[model samples]
Target: MEQHHPSLRSEALALLRSGVTNREVAEKLGVPRGTVGWWLHEDRKARGVVVAERPHNCPRCLSLPINRPAYAYLLGLYLGDGHIVAKGKQNHLSIYCCDGWPGLIDDAEDTMRKVLTGTNTGRRAKIGCTEVKSYSKHWTCLFPQHGPGMKHQRRIELSDWQQEIADGFPWELVRGLIHSDGCRFTNWTTRMVGGKRKRYEYPRYYFTNKSDDIRKIFTDTLDRLGVEWRTLARGSDPYNISIARRPSVALMDAHIGPKY
Candidate 1:
């Protein structure tokens, strides 16, 4: 015998819209209880509504609808502490690196633009080595010119600039820049490839008992540079510093110099 009929379907839909229990509606319509559930499911599917089995919100998932900033923040957290491995010898971590602020040239003019008018919503605000090269050779040619015939001078110059930039950003920033997400200032070290020696020091910056001093130092530098920055302290432990602009080797060398 055919169970489903137009009258039963209409009654089921009406009962569902009226908030009647599926079992009640099934009994009233002389159909199995699952029939009501299947109808509701099909209705939702037809309307393109995804009803998650567990109906709770994940902040990380919800953040995407708001803005890219929220999305990026969620992404950073995900990259930082989201996953784990079981019995794997190698620890895999990923970090973000912007080669250059694609559209923004790394000249005084572009810097001025950034200072005056901030970046757009989707655009990333940072000076990359690639963008730096296009505008001026100041960063690329910091050292004394050696020979008359400089065949591959720019490439060599760029490598030097890269190293300088890498060194300038407090080792913490350097670590973050190189390894986009996983690298932390505390308890993280850089070692030489295939060697036992540690190439760079961990906990690059010192934090004293005085909280104001740390805030002052960070704020003063940012104010002088006309840049925006934020620092979050992890329960009186090491703090994480995030800046609007990526550290430039040329600028760092000029500002802080070798002593810093």
Candidate 2:
């Protein structure tokens, strides 16, 4: 049998424990990041290393209470496949609509109304609706109707009266609603595709949540909903978003009805 490179593996584990990034360790070891991860995994099995411990401080700002996952979820919504058309200086709101989305105009209006109203309590209300005025802004919906290069239809912006309704919501509720709305919108896009063609089209659906408040609400809601979520590392590269396929039907049965 060939001699095992235990020393190299130990060195890799040491590097990981020393706060060196996997990429850096991989570079030093002349191997892929996956290789580093594999080495660490093997060492964990052999040495009985437990790596699931939580940190005392936050991961994003690293202040306290460990709320980084929330920030990451929000950032993901901002960076993922979406459009941020010019709205005003130092201000732009992002919007994303998928091809498989049913009743595009209606959904957009529903989202707008929810963000403006601040509650998901009504019989016909969608989750993430909020009565927060500070967060509401003029947003346009662009969807393909007949074919390519179609004229983009503009949905009516929130009116002054609607703004009055939104202004009534508390600040915390407003933040929660916006974050939850982003999650709902992103989840909808992910589930929109169907059939054999879906294999090729499914992965394109994405959302980024760049705000601290947005991230916290999303992860907290996910935890409350008992859904699995992961935080991504910072980089210029894109991250994959995957939802558990087994839970889809059950989740839908719990909230969505035939009318939805």
Candidate 3:
């Protein structure tokens, strides 16, 4: 950085405080653009004005084009297992992935970056899982479901734009939801077939969520995709949505297999 006269900085600050753009001030004063920006920043700091970082390029707010499929998938993951923390100096969207599935962790981070282009993302290791986090103040703007309580305890509903994306990319949403809160496993039973004992294996998919609204969202999407799902009661609460029909299971297998 080149040193400049104190009087030049004073003149730059005067221009900046008077609504002159940094570039314009730099151009009029023959100062470098970077120096003008730095001076303006310093002036604001000295005057007790908090200099916020450049605003994130929010697709919804800016009417900017976004990767809809990626957004759809990330939304599902968020509804199923991710959350946003917006507080003093602590704002981010975090999706937790089981450590056993390193690939899913990577995919979660990648999908977040894709949706929030050029955003900063990092990971934190937790017991039995890793939290893939994207730092942004606009996460709540993107995911309106973020609120003051647990998702299951709150009413979760997507906005019109989100519903449109989910409709367009139903499979991706299903994949993300399954990767977060659903699982595929094989159930075996022995049966007598023509006087011979035979073992039969049935592969099924299950999505478990305590939130009625989230469950409805999942089931409604399944209905739109022509895939059948049934509710299975666990103890007193029916938190499991099971896809056991051969055709439905096959559809799920074709679209969203076991997590990698």
lDDT of 1: 0.37
Return the clash pairs for model 1, or none. 95-180, 95-181, 96-180, 100-128
Regarding lDDT, does 1 or 3 come out ahead? 3
Per-candidate clashes, comma-separated: 4, 22, 0
Q: What tens digits encode model 2's per-residue C-alpha lDDT throughout 166-236?
A: 23322222222333332332222323345333322221112244434334444454455554555554585
Task: Name the lDDT of candidate 2.
Answer: 0.38
Tens-digit lDDT string for candidate 3 (1-260)? 99999999999998889999999999999999999988877777878998667667888778899899999999989999999999865589999999988999999999999898878999999999999999988888899999998999988998998999999999999999999999999988999999999999999899999999999999999999999889999789999999999999998989899988
Model 2 sits at a Cα RMSD from the real structure of 22.8
Higher-ranked by TM-score: 1 or 3: 3
Error of 2 at 245 (Å): 6.9
Predicted structure with the largest TM-score when compared to the true one: 3
Per residue, candidate 1 scores C-alpha lDDT tens digits across 99-198 of: 5322222222232223213221122244442211111111112122212332222222213432333234333222222232222233445777776766
Q: Relative to the true structure, how large is the alpha-carbon lDDT of every model?
A: 0.37, 0.38, 0.92
Could you tell me the lDDT of residue 69 within candidate 1? 28
Best by lDDT: 3
Give the root-mean-square deviation of each candidate in angstroms: 21.4, 22.8, 8.1
TM-score, candidate number 1: 0.21
